[model samples]
Target chain A: MIEVKNLVKTYGDKRAVAGISFKANDGEILGFLGPNGAGKSTTMNILTGYLSSTSGEAYINGHDILEDPIAAKREIGYLPEFPPLYLDMTVKEYLYFVYELRGCRLPRNTHLKEICELVKIDNVYNRRINNLSKGYKQRVGLAQALVGNPNVLILDEPTVGLDPKQIIEIRTLIKKLGKNHTVILSSHILSEVQAVCDRIVVINQGKIVADDTADNLSRELTADHKLIARIDGPKDEVIKLVQTIPGVVSIVADMQRERGVWEYNIEAVEGTDIRRELNRRLMSRNWYILGLRSSELSLEDIFLKLTMGESVNEFLADKADDLEERYKEEE
Target chain B: MNAILKREIRAYFDSLIGYIYITAFFAGSGILFSVSSLQYGSTDMSGMYSGLFYILLVLIPILTMRTLSEEKRQKTDQLLLTAPISLTSLVLGKFVAAMLIYSIGVCMTIVYATVVSFFGAVSWLTVFGNVVGLLLLGAAYIAVGMLISSLTENQVIAAIGGFAAMLVLYLISAIATIIPVDWIARIFTELSFAERYSPFTYGVFDFSNVLFFISATVIFLFLTIRVLERRRWS
Candidate 1:
């Protein structure tokens, strides 16, 4: 288990990591999702004992990182944003160096061979790291981290630069690693984390804006009931008919789809399903209901909303104001 | 520490810098030895030892420049720092690696001394004393160069900075002679590495000078550890 309490790191006047606290249970893959300049890398560095925090305590398996650094570091295998590589050394030589550097007690040859095979770099093991492709280099870096078999693996942007196939392969590997190790992976890519992580901590501007399972976060942020409908009728008539339906709170003609067919965005009262009611009302008027679907926000929209510092209520209010302006212009 | 020591030593041999440094040391000392001792058929090797000291001012930087700086530049310091090793061991490992390479060049001087013994009466005491003194002095210089290397990520800057720093230490006695104030000049003379190093060439085994070189090496190594530790907090 890893726990961080009120960790803060400041560089001069700029606060890079501002008093963030969280915990990762054993055998859990926790993803740190953030944009550039967020404190994901800084926090990872501190956790790995590479950088000291200004005022806080980080514990790895009950040993405080600052007070008992050697023990804490012994449990962590870190792959920084840029994989620290000795370009002059071959893959085999580099892994051996890291193996000795970490003071691994396991049988050296078998351990290294297993890691090389696990990362699928056994073919390129004899080549110098400088000659390998980016994907191979990243695998070698991951292989470096796996040498000592530390219980906690801290990876920063592990798939920042890779082809889609390689990215998937790495993601699969991470998922496999997550079964046994407490892996903390940081990435700016939302789907990567959503696909691989058991839980996510969404950080923005040096603070965590949201933390929960991906499904929980999606469910929590998407509480406001909204629907999209395409109707074959006069735009104003469709809007007027949709607003009169019971439990329908607001309706706006979003955009014209085709000749006399307009797509409308409608909001309803909480816990109300407006789809059936709106469909019945529109069909009763002989206005064709071309298509209708509830607009549940995706994780991408939630990510933007949380990071941009715009709450869901504020977003809905902005849309309401836009609707009011459009109505006034028509009048 | 052993792992780091082994890797650094291997790295020295893996790149051309280590070969160039040792070859240059031998070549530079050969030219000086031939001109000062062999060409004149002089039995005294003190003048040739002094010339090797000057050659060290140029060659030591080449040996020590990339020790720590290249680790930072390539981000390999991340691997070293994050490993379960103390800062002292990390610094000492690299310090010892550079000293070992330098010792290889210093050891060749013994062969030169033996060669001279064939031609005429050679003071083995003075030659042995000079070898010990040179090793001690080279340790101090390597420590200083390694300290400068830890302060920057650019190898070129580390090399130039190490050269400049060693040059100051080499000329400090001459610099003292030019100073107007008596007490300040005396202090400069006291601090001059060359001033302390010259006595061993004459077979004077000054215990205090040995202590001085050892202490300088220890102090610089300590400061290098501090620099690395300070980087983590910063």
Candidate 2:
């Protein structure tokens, strides 16, 4: 188990990591999702004992990172954003170095061989690190972290530069690793985190905006009774008709779907289902309801809503304004 | 510490720096020995040993430049710092590795002394004294170079900075002589490495000089550890 309490790191006058706290239970894969420049890497660095936090305490398996660094560090396997590798050494030589560096007590040869096979870098085992491709280098870095088999594995942007195939392979490997180790993975890609992590922590500007399982986050943050309708009618008339329906809070013709048909994003008041009323009004006015669906927020939408500090209503309003500007430009 | 020491020693040989350092030290000392003693048929090897001191100023930087700076540049310091090792061991490991390679080069001087003894009656006692003094002086120089290396990530900057530091220490006594203030010059003279190192060449084995070199090495090594620890906070 890993726990961080009110961790803050500041560089000069800039607060890189504001006070943020979270915990990762045993055998859990916790994904840290954020845009670039968020404190994901900084927090991971502090957790790994690489950088000291300004105010708070980080504990690895009950040992405080600052107070008992050696024991705390012994429990963590960290792969930073950039894999820390010695380019001059071969994969075999580099792994051996890390093995000894971590003071691993396991049988050295068999333990290293198993890690290489697990990460699928056994083919390139004898090649010098500088000669391998980026994906292989990353895997070798992962292999180095896996050498000591520490209880906690902290990986920062592990799949940042891999190809799609390699990305899937690494994701699968991480899923397997999570079965036995508490893995904290950080990434900017929303889908990758949603696909691989058991829980997601969305961070924005050095603060935890939301933290829960991906399903729970989406369920809790879904916009209040929203519906998306594709209407085949005059744009101005459709907007006016949808406005007349009761319980409809707002309506915006968002995007042109098929020439004259446009997708309208409709928001209703809380606990109100306006889908049937919206369809009846549009059809009574001879506006064809080409398609209709309840708008449930995806992980991406929840991520943006949390990070951008914009509610769903304001977000649609901004889109409607942009659409109006485009219409004026065309005229 | 042992792991880092082994890897650092192996790293020196894996690249051309180790070969270049050994070759330069051997060639420079060989030429100096042949010119100062062999050509003159003089068995007094003190002149040869003293002349090699200048050669060390140039080579020490080359040996110690990449000890810590390259680790920072390649971002491999993360691996080292995150490993379950104390900062003291990390610093000491690199220091000892550089010193080991330097000792290999300094030990080659014994070969030159052995060759000289074949022709003339050589004083083994003075030669042993000079060897011990040279090793102690090299330890101090390596520590200073490693300290500068720890301050920067650019290998070129580390090398140039190490050279500049070595130059200041080499000329500190001369720089002190030019100062008119008596008390300040005396302090500078007291700090001068050259002032303390000259007695070893003349067969004067002073316990104080040995203490000076050992203390200088320890002090610099300690400061290097402090720099590394300070970086984590920064």
Candidate 3:
């Protein structure tokens, strides 16, 4: 498990990472979602011991990151935004050097060989990193990070430039790796996090805005569930009937309005399914129903609603506004 | 450290800097040797060694120019920094590699010493002392070059900076003649690399001058380490 207690990073007068605390459990795939300069990379760099924090502390497993850096570093594998590889060394040589530098002590050459096979870059092991395509080089980079088989893997934008097929393959690999190691992957693609990560930490500016399970965040942000209904009747009459339903809130006349059939959107209370009730009542009224659908909050909408879409300081201000409003309402 | 040293040497060979340096230095000395000693009917082996000392100002910069700068350009320093080794070991390894190559060129001057053995009587002690002084002098030059190389990421800047620095040291003797040999100038002239080496070429082993050469080498290398470490902070 990883614990961060009031982690803060300040650059001169600006605080890139404000006093924030969170925990990432073992065998968990945590996603860090944020825009550029949101302190996601800074946080990761500090955790990996690449950069020292201005204040606060991070504990990887039981070891303090600052006090016991080498031990903490030994348990973590980091792939920074830029894949740090010797351009002159071939894939095989670079990985071996990393193995030695990491002081794995064992025959890490065999370990690297196996990881290259695992990441499917065995064929390009002889190629110089500068010569390979971006995707293959990324795999080579991943192979280097994974060579020591650290318990924690921190990947910064791991699949930014991959094709659809390669993205799928890497996502699957991350998922498989997540079974054994604690993984923290950072990206702007909410759907990618929704797909692979068990938990998500949405950050804005330098502060974490939302942290929860994918389903929980989506559910918490949804104010109401939306649905579409199609009825076989005069268009105006169907619209009026949908409006009369106690649970139904609004309707919009959609395509196929020319004929005696009408299709309209239905907004109902969240977690209340009105589709079966509408179908039963419409059948009793001798109204032939055409189509019915309900819309749930998408990850994108939840992301937009939960995040204030500004600096972390700004987001914090908006959060303070939310608290003040709640306080006034209570008063 | 060995890994870094090996790669640095290989990088030098892979690029033209290494080729141009080894070629020009050895070739320049070969030409100067053939023309001065072989052509002029002079068999004083020490004359040839002294000739190589003058050649050093131009060639040592080439040998050490890209030592640290190329690592910064190609983003390869990240690899060395993130490695498990300490900063001192890494910098020393690269410095030592460049120093070893310099020793190779100085070792080549031994051929002139051997050639003189057939024609005229050569004092083995003086010849050995001159060779030792040349090695120490070349080491000091290379260390100065390495320090300059660490200050910039541009190979051209590093090379020019190193050349300029060595240029100052090479002209130290001439500078002594122009300036007052009073207390200050005399003290500065005592620091001149060539002035200190005059005893070695004359078959006199001056331990104090040798100590000065070693100290210059150690100071420059220590400065290089500090500059490299400061970069991580920046």
Candidate 1's DockQ is 0.75
- Which digits, one per residue and each the tens of the lDDT, describe model 1 over residues B121-233? 99988999999999999999999999999999998899999999999997899999999999999999999999999898778999999999999999999999999999999
iRMS of every model, one decimal?
Answer: 0.7, 0.5, 2.6
User: Deviation in angstroms for A178 in model 2?
Assistant: 1.4
Candidate 1's TM-score reads 0.87
Q: What is the TM-score of chain A alone in each candidate?
A: 0.77, 0.79, 0.74
> What value does the lDDT take at residue A281 in candidate 3?
69
C-alpha RMSD over true interface residues, model 2: 0.5
Once model 2 is optimally superposed onto the true structure by TM-score, how far is the C-alpha of residue A120 displaced, in angstroms? 0.8
TM-score of each: 0.87, 0.90, 0.78
Go through the candidates in order and give the clash count of each: 0, 0, 2
Instruction: Tell me model 3's lDDT, rounded to 2 decimals.
Output: 0.78
List the candidate numbers ranked by TM-score, top first.
Answer: 2, 1, 3
Predicted structure 1: lDDT: 0.89
Question: Second chain of candidate 3: TM-score?
Answer: 0.92
The residue ranges of model 3 lying beyond 4 angstroms of the native Cα positions read: A1-3, A12-14, A59-69, A221-304, A307-331, B169-187, B197-199
